[model samples]
Each structure stands twice: as C-alpha cells, then as structure tokens.
Target chain A: MSLYRPPRTQSSEITPREVYLSRRSFMAGTAAGLAFAASGTALAAPLAATPSAYKVADKLTPKQDVTTYNNFYEFGVNKSDPAANSGDFKPTPWAIEVGGLVAKPQVIDLEKIMTEIPMEERVYRMRCVETWSMVIPWIGFPLSALLDRVEPLGSAKYVAFETVVRPAEMPGQSGFFQPLNWPYVEGLRLDEARHPLTILATGLYGETLPNQNGAPIRLVVPWKYGFKGVKSIVKITLTEKEPPTTWKNSGPSEYGFYANVNPAVDHPRWSQATERRIGEGDGLFGGRRVDTLPFNGYADEVAGLYAGMDLKKFY
Target chain B: MALPALPARLKPASVWALYALGLMPGLYAFYLGIYGGLGADPVREFEHLLGTWALRFLCAGLVITPIRDLLSVNLIAYRRALGLIAFYYVLAHFTVYLTLDRGLILTSILGDILKRPYIMLGMVGLLILIPLALTSNRWSIRRLGSRWNSLHKLAYPLLLAALLHYVLSLKSITLEPAIYIAVVTVLLGYRLVRPKLMERRRARRVTATR
Candidate 1:
C-alpha cells in the first residue's frame, strides 16, 4: 500500500470540506428526523444545475426556510403549520390522471414521470399573493413535456390541476370550517400551461421534495402568484372552458382566474407594491421588502403570452 | 363550584410570580431571535408571539370578573397585574411593528395606520389601553377614585377592537379567531346580566326575612 492514499474521488475532493461536511450532516439529519431542527445553515447544499438562460441571478432562499415556510393549505392555514403537520402525509405511490379533451387520457405513476422526463434545475422567483417572495432552485421537467405526452386536442383551451384531498393526510381539509374547498383547484390557459417556464417540479435543492413543499410532484408557474402553482397534484384536466379555481370560487372579486403577479393590482386587503423576501434578514426586522415585480420578474419571457389582454382586468 | 381565594399574605408573592411568568414568552422569543431559531421570519414570528400573548392576557383579565361572580373565586388582587402585563405586550407588539417591520419609516407607519382598517383598529385598541395602563398604579387609583372604574371600563372596547384587528388581519376567517370572539362575547354577556341577578337575590333574601 502506498504511504499516502489517493483522494477517494475527484468530485468529492473538489467540494469544499465544510460544504461536504454540512451536506453529509443535512442528509444524516434528514434521515434521523432532525431536519427541522437543523436551521438554514446546515441544510444549505451546493446544488448542481446546468446553467440556463431562464435561471434567476438572485441568491437561492435557504433550503430550510423554503421547506418550512410553506402555504400548503391542505396541511394547515399557518405558514409553519404545514411543516409541523405534514409529518405523517404519504406522498409515494402517487399517480396523476391526465384526462378531458386529451387525445390519450392516462393515469401516469409518479415514478414513470420521474424516470421518463429529463429533469433540469431552474431557479425561479416565487412571489406569494400575500406579498412575500423567494428565489427557489426547482428540479423538474417542463409542463409542456407532460402535456405533449398527453397530446392535448384542439378543443383543449385550458388546463386545470387538482390537488389530492385526503382528510386523513391533510388536517386542514378535515377541520369543521374547511379553508377553501377541498382538493384545491387551480388553472392556467393552455398556452401558459405549455410555456417553457411552467414546470412540474419533483425536487428542490438536489433532493426529493419535502411533504410540506408538495412532495412527489407539483406545478411551478413562475409568472403567476405562488398559489397558482398547485401542490400535491393528482389530476390534470384539459378543458374547453375556463376551470373554476378554488380561490376564485371562494372570493370572485378578490381572487381572479388569471392570478398573475401584478404590483399594480393590489389584493383588495393589502398593497402588492412590495414583497418581504424570506431568508434575507434585515437585522431585527424579520425580512426586508423589495418592490414587487411584474410577472414576478419573468415578464420578458411571458409578457408576450398575455398580449392584447388587459392585465389589470384579467388579474 | 366555589374556589378558594389566595391568602392575604401570599398576594404580593403570587403577583410577583405571575409577573415573572408573563415575561417568559417574550424572553423565549428574544432567545429564539438571537439563536436563529424563529423560523424563516424572526421579526414576524416575534411580532405575532407578542400580539398573541397580549390578547391572551387581555382575555385572562376580562375573565376575572366572571370567575368571581360564577365560581366565587376572588382574584381581584391579580387583575391589575394581568392588565399591566397585557399593556406591556401590546406596547412591545406596536414597537416591534414600528421599528422592525416598518424600520421606523414614519411615513409608511402613518400611511399603514391610516389606510389599513386592521392597523387602524389595532391603534385604536392601543389608544384605549394607554389611559388604563397609566391609571394602574395606586396613586392614579386614589386620584381618580370612583372615576377610575369608569375610565377602566374602556377595557371592553379595547378587547373588541383587539379581537376585530386580529380577525381582519388574517386573509380568511378561521376557527381560532372565531373562538376568541365567542369567548369575549360570553364574558361581556355575563358582566351585563350579573348585577341584575344579584339584585334579585338580595330582594328574595329580604322577603324571606319579612
């Protein structure tokens, strides 16, 4: 045996020692059910991504914050409730039924979708309708990829997505006063659905998606508010008419169908001109607010798609 | 079901203990903020924590009257302490929102209060509490005398405003806030009807003697 052993692996050697150690601790902590306790620092992993023009230049929100601070109402109403209550939620063995106005309607298993579609890491700015924002690195393939597989017919003018409604799994749905309707529904115009930026994200930060952040798979519509990206999806329907979205159905005046991220159109209750960026602390103040962006800073790529339509009226 | 009152000698010690207990939530929140443990948004968490404790303490203060009337438990000695603690929490909540949330931006703070109904309601609640907090001491009590009771009756409106502020603050109405409203309404209802019931009982006693 040589006096000095060669490096275990070239890639491992290239990674900073602290990063490697932290990543190991993160994985170990996650396995040990100590992930929530591991704050934002230890969970920061160096995710690998093929550089794309679509990627945002902003820093990624800390993985711990992004995972813990979620608005999956199926789990609960509070931001922290989802992470706390979603421990028992089972996301595996998932199948999404793609039907209605499609040439070939089928229920595809999540595993098949994961293996068949080529996953790409895309950093996108997610703006909540509640006036909070985060830059997330989502790993998944485009919604177009799935739509193409389904072969949507000419009659299909809109795409609707429905989340899984399991009272046993989702505590919010079981409560006496349900938060919105169960099996939360969201929709997108066919063109918007097929846009390259609309992705069906399966993972984030080089790891499988956590339950609170919509495990197994979820939609990622960068241009619209975060709620437009429905989570834990179990159904995708192509329709000739506009679909009834949960929020829109609940409050027609407040939540419109085309819930685009527009600073000009405030959410009746609060101003949308500014957004608090999570994970970016401002000393004693929790998070600092920056001016909200039109189309959540993806206007250049998606603005043309809404051409001739009055955004304020549509919004 | 009658509950025993605390011994006269233990009153001071008990009040001090309750005061120390009331500080726990704020202290815990501060520790969390310093240690990077307040989740994603520490300021928001801190603000919410302080606001919640303020509401809880207010509810506790209001329930003292009902507890005495119904259960015959006399907790009058601690009522002022509870109210003072609530005032402290409300002050902390307002300070955090102004300094940390708004970064002491005067224009924005004033604008928010003017424009937002919920913020306005919260300010009104705080304004109601100011006089009560000021008059909590023995000197002010002696100066005001009977007028002190009338001045402190503002607690009812303050509680209502605080609850309304909380309900409207949320994007959607949920069970938690609704329950708080119900509890406060019940307590107020008890206060409204108790004196009449006591007068009837006194009349019955006099008639029995006759």
Candidate 2:
C-alpha cells in the first residue's frame, strides 16, 4: 500500500535533524511493525493508497517523561490535573466494544488489541485548542483499518466516538463548569475518518500508554485540536448525520461542529497560527517556535476535501 | 499617654499563621511544576496559577474592611501583611509571565501588553500593588505619618484594577470575578460611608447631653 503523501508547499524545507530522527524511529519501530505484519489479520482492510511522511523524531522523551506528563481533563482545568488526580482511576481489566454499522462488531480486550495491530511510529505535531503544542511519537495504526472492519452503511456520513464514563474514576464529572460531557464525545466526517492522518493510537513515545494519557486506547486526529480526539474510548457509532460532538454542544460558536483544524481561523481568545512547542528544549534558553500549518500541515491531502467550503463560517 | 493602642488584641502571630496557610497553595503549585504537574503547558499553568493567587489575595485584602466593619473582627494587624502578599503574588505572576511565557523579551511583552486589554488590566493591577507593598511596613507608615493613610488608600484603586483584570481575562463575564467585584464594593463602601454615620450619632448624643 502506498503511504499517504501530502503535497508539501515547500518540499525543500526538511531539516537534517528531521531526516535523522525519521530513519531512527522507523528502524526502532520495526519490531512492532513486524509483529503486525505477522498477525495474519486481513479484517476488512481498505485501500490506503496515499503514502505518508509521518516519521518520529529522535529526541522523543522517555517513558518517564511521557507517562508523568499528561493533559487529562478528568481532574480539572489544569493540564497537570490528570497526573495529580489520576491516582484515583483504575484502568485495569479494560475492554473496548467496537460495535456500530460494521460487518464485524466485536468486543476486544486491550491485550489482544495492542498485540493484534501493527504499531507504526509517527511524529505528529499535536496542537491543543488552548494554543500550546508538542511533537509526539505515537505508535498506532490507521483508524481506517479498524473502521473498515465495522463496514459502515452507505448512509453513514459521520462517525461518533465516546469515552468510558465512570464518575468514580473521573472526578471532573462532578464539576459544574465542565466544557465537555463527563464521558466526552467527538466526531468526524466520514471522509475525515478515512483521512490518512487519523489513527487509533495505543501508545506514545514508544511505550504503552499511561492511564493519564488515555491508557487502553484513544484516537489521534492530528489536524483537529487535541479535544477532538476522544480518549479512553469505549464506543463508536456511525450515523447518517453529523454526530453530536461535545465541544460543539457546549459552545457551538466557539467550537464548530466540524472542528477541522485551520490556522487561518483564530480561536476566540487566541490565535491558532502559531503555538508554543512544549518540551522542545530548556525552559529558559531558546524555546522553540513552530508555525502551525493548516490541517496541522496535512493540507496537501485534506485540503482538497474542503476546497469550496468557507472555513471562516465553519470555524 | 495613648497606651500603645493595646495592639488591637489580635496577635501578629495569628496573622503569620494565616499567611503560612495561604502559601500552601502556591507551594503546591511549585511542587506540581517540579513533578511535571504543569504537564505539556507549564507556562500557561504558571501564568494562570500566579494570576489567580494575585487576584485571590487582592480580593482577600479588600475583604479586610468589610469583615472588620460588619463583623467587627478588627483584622487590622493582618491587613498590611495580606496586602503585601497580594503584591508579592502579583509580582511573581508578572515575573513568570514575562520570563517564561514572553521570554522577558521587552519587545514582545510590551506588544502583548499593548495589544491585549486583559494584559493591560493585569499590568495595571500589578503596578498598583507595588506601591502598596513598598509602603506596607511600619517604617513607611511612621515616616509618611498622616500621609501614610492617604497613600495606602490606593488599595481601593488596586482592588478595582485587579477586578478589571479578572473580568477581562475571561472570554465571558464569569460569576466568580463578578462576585469578587461585588464583595470588594461592599467592603470599600463600608469604609467610605460608615465614619459619617458614627460622627452624626456622636453629635446627636452631645446635643442631648447639653
């Protein structure tokens, strides 16, 4: 299968460092990739023709750095809240029920799911709606592979994903000013779901995901803001109409239903054109600045999908 | 002899205890930073935490009069300390924002301050707090004498600036900051109007004696 290759507006701008990290991560990821190739699983695979340049960076933070660092909303508005309060959560004995408008809707255990799928190491620039971002090496498979197995009907125009909600485990559920539902819900246009950048991420920074980082499983749509990728997912429902996304429900104007990442559209409070890259370097010395790209710089492939639509209205 | 005003019967040690308790949250914030509790966005958390403590102390300092007048708590011994703490947190707040968030680059910080009204409000609040903090000690009070009371009257202006800072910081007029503004007004109102009422009552009593 040809990897999805987004057209680079400036193909000449690849840094030597990026190239080195790409080669290194690809080699390191061989064990996981080989395990996937050996799984002998051909479950409703779709035609993934676009070759992608998603490569992991070399200086990826270790497990200690990734696990200890988190952005879980279950605790509070603070970014560190999930880490501080995640001690109360119990993520063991987890199972993800994948049943919707699909050919095979089976409840898969976490162990089988992780081992069954091939892990591809990809470096993605993750931008939060709050104007901060990070470069992470996430290991996972194209979400299209999983969704193809489900086999959505022709009427299915949208995909709705939901997080597991246990008030005991999620203290933020009790709060009055929750921006999203306690068990958060996110959605994507069917085309967006099939986009090459979408992945059902299981691990990050080359390790099993910590509980605070959505433990068993989660979705990572690099184009959209971080909130659009629902974490600790337990359910997926395909529908004819657009799914009722949590952020849009909370504030439709502030958060569009589509929520397709567009650097051109500034958030009500801050600009989305640029972001402060976290963990880039020393806190005091020469912090890094990376320009945010449209559709998280995946515009080469995804831009054609929204060529005629007005981003300002949808934004 | 004035009898040293009897120190108002409220010990300074108790005030010190309250200050220590307030430090817990700030210290916990620092611990969180060290533990990577600030997560992927420590700068935002740092700015938010420091800004919040600055506002909280600003409100707490404002509450001194309302509590004293309405409940007659005579919290005079702690007002200076509390006001100074508010100023200290505001300084920390500005320092963190300028150093971490803005990289202490004068050009960017100044541009941000000028471009964003909310930043300007917070800057004004911090500026107002500085004078109050500088003149908070007993030595300043003694040196300034009668002028000290008038100069420290700047607390009202600082409170207004801080409240405005809170209001503008949010996308909406949240109830939390609105409640703070309302509380500060009532507190300052007590100080502004209560003395006149007492003076009128004293004159009436003297006339009755004659």
Candidate 3:
C-alpha cells in the first residue's frame, strides 16, 4: 500500500471546532427532520463529522433554503425542480468505481468507504455560475484521501468524474430534449483534484445529503463555481490528457474547463463581478448583491496551484 | 372558425375591462413575489416573472394583427390596449431591474448594458416603446394621421429586440426558450405575407360578387 500521507491542518492553526459547529443538537434534532416530515419527504441519517479548518466568516445559507434550492439537473433544470422531482432517486446500496491509470482500480461500497476515511465539516462559500452564492456546511473528507487510496500512476495527470446515468431514476435524463448530455461529466487537473480545499461531500447541516443536494456523494471545490462540483458521482478515472467537461462542451464560449470563480472574467450573458448572497438579509431584501472575490476568496490557499500559468487563457 | 362580435353598445365597457384584465397576471405575480411564492431568490424570480410577462404581452400584441388577417378574427380594437399593457409591463420590469435587481448600482447596471448583448437588446426595446407609448393616444393619433401608422410600425423592431433579449437571457437554447423563439419568429414572419394574402382575399371577393 502507498504510504504518501497528505498534510493535516494543525489544531492551533485550525478554526476552533466549537466556534464553527454551533447549534449542533438543534440541527441534529428537529429543524431539518421537521421540515422534511412536514413536506412528507424521507430524511437521510445524521452525519457525524469533525469540524475542519476550512470555514468562512459569512453566515450559513439557511438549511431550508440550501436543501430546497438545488441545481441537480439529473432531477431537472429549474432551481426548484430538483427538490420537487428527486423523490424517486435511490442513493442506498451505491458503490463508486475508481479505475483508469490507477495502480489499484477497484469498486468501493459507499458505507465502507465512508467508515474508512475521516470526514470533516467544512463551512465553504459556494459561488454558482449564475452569480449566486451560498455558505454551506458540508461533511466530507479531502479528495486527496480518496486519491491516495486509489494510488494514481505517474502517467495520471487529470482526474475525471462521471455522474451516474439512471434514466429510470433521473427524469431529467429521460426527457426528449435533455438540457445537458447524459452521464453528466466533469474533470479537474490532478493538482486541483488533490488540493486540500477540494472535498468529496456526503452530507450537509449535520445530516446526510438530501437527494436534491446530490444524495450519497458529491464533490465540493470552494474556489470554483458550483457547477464544477459534480453531483451524485459514480465513477472517477485518472487520465494523461485533459478530459472535456460538461459545461465546456455545452457552451464553449461561456463555460471554461477551469470554472474558477473569477469575478474579473465576465460571463457572456451576465457579469461575474458581483454575486447575490442567497438568504442574506431579512424578509423581501433577503438576497443582497455583494462583490465576488477572485478564486472565491480562496486565492490565499490555492492560487499557488496556478502560479506561472495565465488563468485567463487556461480558464 | 368565427369569433362572436361584441355588441356595439357593450364594446366600450368590454374594451376597458380588457385593459384591466390584461394587467391581472403582472399584479398576481407581484403579489406572489411580495408573499414569497417566487422561491428562495425571490428578487430574481420576481424580476424574471415581470420580464417574462412583458414578453408574453408583446407576443399577445403581435398575435393580434395575425389573427385579424389569417383567422378573420377582429381583435383590432384591443390592439391599442395590448400595446399599452405591454409597455406598462415593460416599465414594471425595468423598474424591478434597476431598483431591485441592480439595487440602483449605476456603475454595475451601465457596465451590464454596455457589455451584455441581452441587456442591450432589452434596453433598446424599452427605448423604442417609449415613443410608441407616448403617441398611443387619441390626440397624437388625430394629429399624426397617416404618419402615426408608419411610426407605430416600430412595433416590428421592438418585437425583434425584445425576442432577442428574451432568448439571450437564457444560458443556452434550451427547449422552452427555443420554442418561444420559434413561435415569435412565425408570428413576425406572417406579417410579411399578410399584404399579399389580403390582396388575394379582396380579389376573390370581387370575383365572387361578379
């Protein structure tokens, strides 16, 4: 077995667990369960995660809003469509297939994998390509943990992720005119994939992931736009050549493979200079437009990953 | 394939009622938006609803002439109200955009207008409608006479601008947006062949009378 261990954030440098993990019992108790019960939707088991160093000063987007407003196109295209239409999605009995250019390619059962790796609660700021942002408390381990397990070969330069294509379960895929190509795919440079900030999220808000929010497993890259965090991933492959990403294929001019949250790079239809912080204010003025940050304010940590390369060109 | 004619005495009341009815959707959407029926990002949803209603009214306005020409349905009397209602929705949509969406951020709004083709098209459509809305009165119509019809022909270009604005607002040409583009294109395309169709109808009537 490979013994290359990734660095861990020191307890002194890390944000105190108590400071970030407030209202724990309440979140684990009634709030989410009551909402789902009232809506007549089944809730997943509560997840226990060690609070990680990764965090933001911003208030978390309300759990209700976070769970309800989703963009899992496997469910549908509209923001609300996912929550309403994901009733049929089955996340249990899932297994992720890791193969291609890896020293040991094997299928790992979801529960077994979760138990093996140490998961953490990372409060990350998620900026969507639509110019909306949410501060989410995600429960997952660093992707590097999984990468180390698979043991990438020297030839592996990029990591490609693929969401499962279950037309029977995912209505969006079965539709005559699909918004995106099936088996929705995304990729990252090997270095970016292994970045400490990158994670494979299994839960949020002290609970297992709601089906609308990618269910059993998903990726979370804080520096990049939300779309880059591919959901309900079933397969991961390492390749020498850069893999084509879904959004890049769908709209080449508008979406780049390196979908980093760069405010300077304006989208063709809208500006990226600012973003609406979802559920920010009270009542009607709930969403406030705030200036977007380069690399979504993670430049301090991850900017060195692209030191010499021009982000504008690569983006 | 024939529409019932409004009684001559009731026409005025019906016309006023039509004007009021035309505004119901905008009012309902506004009410829903205020009450939080529009979802988490209500401001954007409300703005989108207003803009979408503006487009629907524009489409309804364009459909009037075509219905009169092809289907022999005389909706000509409501044309002014349709155009005026559309202008009102456009005004509402623009107000929401400036005050709510952009939060009166002049620099950001101006930058968006300058850079975004979608915003530019919407702005141009608004500009074109201003003069039309100003002249859509009895006094201006009497004074301008034949010139009014020529001026009001700005509807064609206004429709084009609004359609492009609507289409461009979407991330890509998805089914819904594509359908909207197709329907509106057909409506505008019908306007070109309308004259010939009317001329043929006139000739046919003359021959039948003889």
Q: What is the TM-score of each candidate against the true structure?
A: 0.89, 0.72, 0.92
Give candidate 3 misplaced runs (Cα > 4 Å): A1-35, A38-41
Best by DockQ: 3
**In what order do the candidates fall by DockQ, top score first?**
3, 1, 2
How much is A52 displaced in model 2, in angstroms? 8.8
Better of 1 and 2 by lDDT: 1
Global fold similarity of model 2 (TM-score)? 0.72
Question: What TM-score would chain B receive for each of the candidates shown?
Answer: 0.94, 0.84, 0.94
Model 2, chain B only, scores a TM-score of 0.84
Better model by TM-score: candidate 1 vs candidate 3: 3
Q: Tens-digit lDDT track for model 3 on B48-164?
A: 877887888888888988887778898888888888999998999999889888999898899999999999999999999999999989999999999999999999899899989
Q: What 10-residue stretch in candidate 2 chain A is worst by lDDT?
A: A40-49
**Lowest lDDT 10-residue stretch of candidate 1 chain A:** A1-10
Q: Which residue pairs show collisions in model 2?
A: A3-A50, A3-A51, A3-A52, A4-A50, A4-A51, A4-A52, A5-A51, A102-A150, A103-A150
Candidate 3, position B191, lDDT: 84
> Which 10 consecutive positions of candidate 3 chain A have the poorest summed lDDT?
A1-10
* DockQ each: 0.40, 0.20, 0.54
